[model samples]
Target: MNETIIRPNPSIVYMIFQLKTNQPSSKLIYSIGPNGVFPDTQGMLQQHSDAISTVIDYSQGETSEVSYLKLRRSHGVINMTSWSILMIMGYIIARHFKKWDPIWFYLHASIQTISFVAGTAGILIGYALSKKVDANVNNHKNIAIIILVLGILQVFAIILRPKPESKLRKYWNWYHHYIGRILIIFAIANTIYGLSLAKEGSKWFLAYGISIAILVIITIILEVRMWIVARRKTQSTNNSSHPQSLEFAYQT
Candidate 1:
């Protein structure tokens, strides 16, 4: 049987075929031109056919290209979903559930932990996939590394968090919040890049886009409501502070 392999960039094409029925040797014929077509050379073909070839045995447990592609797709899904939950839902819980106090903290921590684990698993899978394919996706790889590092730092910061009344608590909070925001930004960008590379279609992009939009809307509404409540409390406190006005109103 013969196999044709197409390299993505530079568009090189290779055709591999067995030389003899009794031998395990194979020969490779490659072409470098547009649309897998190039000038045919009888001398080159004869030379390759006469030379010895190395047989690649696949009877053992070797992963096929198709399986590698499937694994890559799965990795992309895991990473994208994990980061989305970590950034969107986690932020929502932290921001809107301030009244819940320690409970909100626990909930946020649990969600973040789960997402981090999933994201880490996905990154590992991606590393393996890239190795298998010998890919040179520098942008995607660099962004993923940054995100993982930020995640690890965030986790460690939580572990060593100071008490609420401690002087270092404010600095810790600033570090955690800013790092998380930057991580989320990079993660989202990397996810979009992965989606484009996979060519998974428009539906996936639409789904994520809608999810982010809804989260933004909810955040805006909650922030406005919190501001209004704070303003009302301030007005009430100011009115209570003016005892002379209160006594004059009573006399009238």
Candidate 2:
């Protein structure tokens, strides 16, 4: 009888999938089987594939804490949300007071400054992660860059705005308001899309939905309060300027 021996080539024998970040060693999930025996283990390998698919499918519909990697993926979303909240607060205060609020201005400046720093960090991480993640790099990355550039320009405008008493002040105000609004819209849209790409869970979606709802309520309240105040001021001024008009109407 002749002696028989077997040697399996690991690479050809097994099928393994791994996630690789640019930073470190890739993590492998599982291996199929030894070379010739792999055909014998087909049933077991199919089972493994099915189990993995089931887990991923379940995760897609679940609400759960985001993984550290997913959070890293959502860096741009976090940055833009922070920036938008600050802008919303600033706009409410400025519009309600009919003049710039120093506190609002300072807060806006601080938030934008922080956002700029965070956005830079995000860009660094995103560039590294983009190469690995299965995402549309062109649309996602290019739009994000445009939003950031616009945000920077808006900050510069805030810093270089004309004095309130200057002849160009009104024009500057319009420019500031329009540009700020445009940046905010872009930020919100990008944030929502980024949230969708967050970990396989519903938490990101819930967080985003709640944020938008709260902001809408706050904005409506602010608008109503400003309108009421403006109406009262107009009534008082009219009463003083034309007191006889009311008296004459009452007599008739």
- Model-by-model lDDT, in order? 0.76, 0.62
RMSD of each: 7.5, 11.5
Model 2, CA-based lDDT: 0.62
Indicate the TM-score of model 2: 0.64
Best by TM-score: 1
Native-to-model Cα distance after best TM-score fit, residue 2 in candidate 2, in Å = 26
Query: Tens-digit lDDT track for model 2 on 1-252?
Result: 133344558544433344345553223223234445443433343222111111132335442332347646466565555556555655655556446557656665676677666666776667666554433456667767877787778778877989889999898988888877787777677667665654436876687678777877988988898789889999998878797887888899
Tens-place lDDT digits, model 1, residues 48-131: 211122324446624322235588888988998887646667877887898998999898988888889999999999999878
Q: Candidate 1: TM-score?
A: 0.73
Using Cα atoms with residue i matched to residue i, what is each candidate's TM-score against the true structure?
0.73, 0.64
Per-model clash counts, in order, read: 0, 0
